[model samples]
Target: MSATPSWQAADGCVHTGPLLQSVNGFDVVACEACGFSHTLPLPTPQELEHIYSHEYYTQEKPLYIERYLEDKAWWDEVYAERYERLEAELPAGRRRLLDIGSGPGLFLAAGRERGWNVMGVEPSERASSYSREVLKLDVRSMFLNEETAPTLGQFDVVNLGEVLEHLPDPAGMLRLVHGLLAPGGMLVALVPNDFNPFQRVLNESMGVAPWWVAPPHHLNYFDTDTLPRLVQRCGFEVRHVETTFPIDLFLLMGHNYIGNDTLGRQAHAMRKTLEMNLRAGGETGRALKSRLHRAFAGLGLGREVLAFARKIDDSPSPA
Candidate 1:
């Protein structure tokens, strides 16, 4: 722990909290007001624009798109689960969806397959182009902001998967989303569950660096507890919060994949196999697997947190 730094949030709140760790010269500290940790000295908006728009998929994470396609089967299953949750919450006829930071648009494509009017907002030109030209999906190649949001119109559900953690102002982004949704519209937000108990065990016992503290890319670090609170603060009523498998358990078990890409792939494959096997093992196995994941979430011991929330009815009418 080091000296806490004074930081200001998007909502004008000042935070000077305990230092968590430093990565790439960026200090991550818990926000005294928001209760979540974020990288200090936030990257400028222009820096973020250049990074995500041009370099994210091409340079920073070159294998991201390829790996996504490689694991298409599992990814489809994951997307299906999200849609099932959204469908369960929304009315039968309500199938309009807007996926913020839609990435390669596989999730939107999945929604379209299920009869939903799906649209996406992605900043990356390469990803957006692939979604439109190759996948033939309607996607806007721009960041979601005040100007861009008004043009997309309203949606019955807004899926913010793996998007919030990258933003400099997560709560502000959610407030924008609150206005984009119809009354009682669902919001499916998925983020990496950093600083969980499993991660602590790995860091303390195994003496591993805080590998998840990625700067310039992941500015905010959130867990199940902090995420739900942030969503509620942005005018949404949380309905459910569940977590995915705790993959860090493998790292604790001596399969250290910190810098080893081959080992990392193996660990990911093992996790996928566990879930896919349960899914393929008939209805009873699927039910059991779902229950197991819920239990993990309850204990706050998962690799990712998937929260479902609905816009509070008292929200202003969409413009």
Candidate 2:
């Protein structure tokens, strides 16, 4: 196969740069300026469009939707936490929420139940239809960009759940999200925590390849430090950075589930079981899990990083 073309880094530097390694047919390189690793020769718009719309939930996982719905109880706990945080931080009376890249409208459903006026922009026909028809959510079946931002108008909160890493130009996408927000509006983004210390330990110490690094489908890699920096540069002030469960902990505990399909499925089921047990224990278990999540986030060991930021008001300060 032919080599892919190089692209400029977030710092605007254009050089061949240093190759970190290769994974799944893509060259992974470390950005000299920002110190974050990204996949080279970012996938084209058409390629990404087809992947997300047609193959993401089907070809990629095959059982993703089924698994997601099966784990709704555990996922709902996560959604509730997110809603509570946003509700507390955001100014009252500004409940307009726009969930960019909302898949199946789970979060939007959570927001609506919280009394927020919620809408979503999803690219997948299957997901969008499910969101609208099944959940009765107000979701536009399209991607969110400069041209589409105007029609959506301003929102008090804009969410990008598990969406940033898929983009070739994540910085550009954040700038668009900045435009979608009202003054003092919040931005919540969740991306895979690739290149983190825990992941490095998995690769270097445990003799496992970097299985977390997927390309084309996931073009950008961000960890705790780099994710917030990228958001700040895009005109949002960072508010909170937290993490979900570090499933890699299973590997550390002698369960090598990465490549083994049966083991991997068991690991997922174990996660759901643990969460369900904790949730059933009521407030005490919930509090303990919250603390554990915060601790994992502090160590930068979670599988995904959740960032909350607010759009900066650039209007001149009162003279």
Candidate 3:
């Protein structure tokens, strides 16, 4: 591991609030100026490279790939809603998509099936190989940075699903994505909802720690308010923002399924079952679920925060 660097905010300030808590040996603090929470002693690029390349899927969570494949039906329903929104927002015939951190090409496969030209950039060799050999998709076995962006060309849609929270410098990543998008193109990002008020209440009620705040893996934390603001600050117009179902509701209602492996798995299975059943109910069920999702998002209590932004034709270059 590289030497631990001094604490700094996205704007380059060195001052920060007192330690919020320590997770996995890294100190967590809120930026005094921006009010965003992040892990102190940020992991170096080399460490992150090694983690994502060698140990991410295999060791970090051994069953991640298998479980991801097992939940395809549920994930497909989520992907379909995102793609439908993208199609409705953009004019017909605009189909090029670039999925950053595309794991096993699920989203890329979903896009391809919907008549879009899809490409992926993933750092995991195992994942890249699977995407190519199994799915026969176009994927680059590397990370997305300024150097690699030119090689991929511009894209009509840039998808960053579940990616922003892992970065040490998320603002820089967003600016880079801004450059890759074509004029009037859209960007869709999904990030975990951390340090949320509802989750805090649930944690207090259950007398348990905040299980979602993992360090090294999840370096940045953002809620519904801050996420869209961050995107707009990066030179994109915020178009839409929504949230996934808040599983914390079960905890608030006295379920307390966090530590019990069986209960946790059952909760996840229940979510998948509900989604699959609704999707099987045809258009009416789909529409009803969509409205329900919107309502949940409006309440600002969801497991994940989903936001969509567009690069305006006359927007200035990202700073």
Name the candidate that leads on TM-score: 1
Query: Across residues 30-141, which tens digit of lDDT does each residue of candidate 2 receive?
Result: 7654446687766677788889888887678777667778778778878988888898888779899999989888889988888999999998888889899999999999
lDDT of 3 by residue, 78-190 (tens): 89989999999999878999999998999999999989999999998888899999999999999998898889998999999989999987888988888888888999999
lDDT of candidate 1?
0.88
TM-score of 1: 0.95
lDDT of 1 by residue, 11-129 (tens): 56687789888889888889886679898878878889999988999998888878889999998888887788788888889999999998889999999999999999999998899
Off by over 4 Å in 2: 1-16, 33-35, 276-284, 315-319
Q: Going through the candidates in order, what is the number of backbone clashes in each? A: 0, 0, 0
Q: Whose lDDT is higher: candidate 1's or candidate 2's?
A: 1
TM-score of each: 0.95, 0.90, 0.92
How much lDDT does each candidate structure score? 0.88, 0.82, 0.84
Clashes of 1: 0
Off by over 4 Å in 1: 8-12, 315-319
What does the lDDT read for residue 236 in candidate 3?
88
Candidate 3 local lDDT, residue 305: 91
